[model samples]
Target: MIQVAAAIIEDEQGRILIARRKPGKSQAGMWEFPGGKIEQGELADDCLRRELMEEMEIEIDPYAFFGVNDHHYGATHIRLIAYRARYVSGTITLTDHDEYRWITARELTAFTFAPADVKFVEMLHSSKPRLNE
Candidate 1:
């Protein structure tokens, strides 16, 4: 089983960030929340922070733990822990993705996301607001 961490990074404007995977990468050309697999002994939040920095050259405040989704593709079983993150700092210099976009809930359906990510997206859409208005 492979353990992965993903962030549903949202800005103050209520837009969520999504990235399109670069060609030749795993699940290439598919869109996903910015994150990666967790290494040994690394906390899930720490892994997510490191991945966001490495992949997008940005820092994230992973203050909220959303939920987890378990998925299996072929012989690999993946456990994806999704977090509700707020943007902290740094410019997004796409190191691994072909493109990035800040999207609204309705815009989410237009992209072709990985099967695993699609589940989380649906969950996010159905979930209540994390911040109090």
Candidate 2:
């Protein structure tokens, strides 16, 4: 199993960040929350912070677990830990993705998302963050 971490990064205006997968890559052109595979022995939040910096050149305050998703595709199954994060600072750079957008919840369905991310986006649109934890 491959472990990964994704951020549901929200801006002050309540818009969520989404990125387009670069062409010729696996799941090319699909929109996804920025993140990458977790390296061995690293905690999930550490992975999220590293991936955001590497992929988008941004810093994040990792807070609140959003949800987890498990999905199988072809030969490998992926386990994704999703988190709610607030963007701290960075210049937007596309190291892995082709494009980025700040979109409202209602706009999520407009993009073609990776199967795992699609579920999370749907949940984001349908529910409020539970704060009693």
Candidate 3:
């Protein structure tokens, strides 16, 4: 199974950030949380931090475990580990995505997300606020 780590980065207003997968990348054109595969031997939290920095040039402090999901996309299967995180610093400068948006949980359904992320989106919409402001 592919080990992945993703963040539910909430802003002061409680909106979460989502990124549009860039063309030429896996799941291109789909909107999803910012994260990447966790390398072997790397902690999920560390992987999340590294991915955020690499993909958006931002820093975050992940807190409170959110949830996990197992998904299969054709021949690729993934186990996504998600966490609730607070933005710490750095302006988001996307390098791997075509666009980015900050939307409230209720607005998640408005965008087309990668299939592997559909459950995460549902969780966010269904659950009470899990992260502290």
Per-candidate RMSD vs. true structure? Answer: 2.2, 3.4, 2.2
TM-score of each: 0.92, 0.93, 0.94
- Candidate 2 lDDT over 8-98, as tens digits, reads 9988777889999998889998999989999999988899999999888899887999899999998899999999999899988997899
CA deviation > 4 Å runs, candidate 2:
128-133
**Model 1 collision count:** 0
Local accuracy of candidate 3 as per-residue lDDT tens digits, 6-34: 99999888889999999999889999988
Best candidate, TM-score-wise? 3
Total clashing pairs for each candidate = 0, 0, 0
Write the residue-wise lDDT of candidate 1 on 82-114 in tens digits. 998999999999988989999876678889999
Clashing pairs in 3: none
**Residue ranges of candidate 1 with Cα displaced over 4 Å:** 128-133
For candidate 1, the per-residue lDDT at 92 reads: 96
Q: What Cα-based lDDT does every candidate model obtain?
A: 0.89, 0.89, 0.91
lDDT of candidate model 1 versus the reference: 0.89
Local lDDT at 11 for model 1: 87
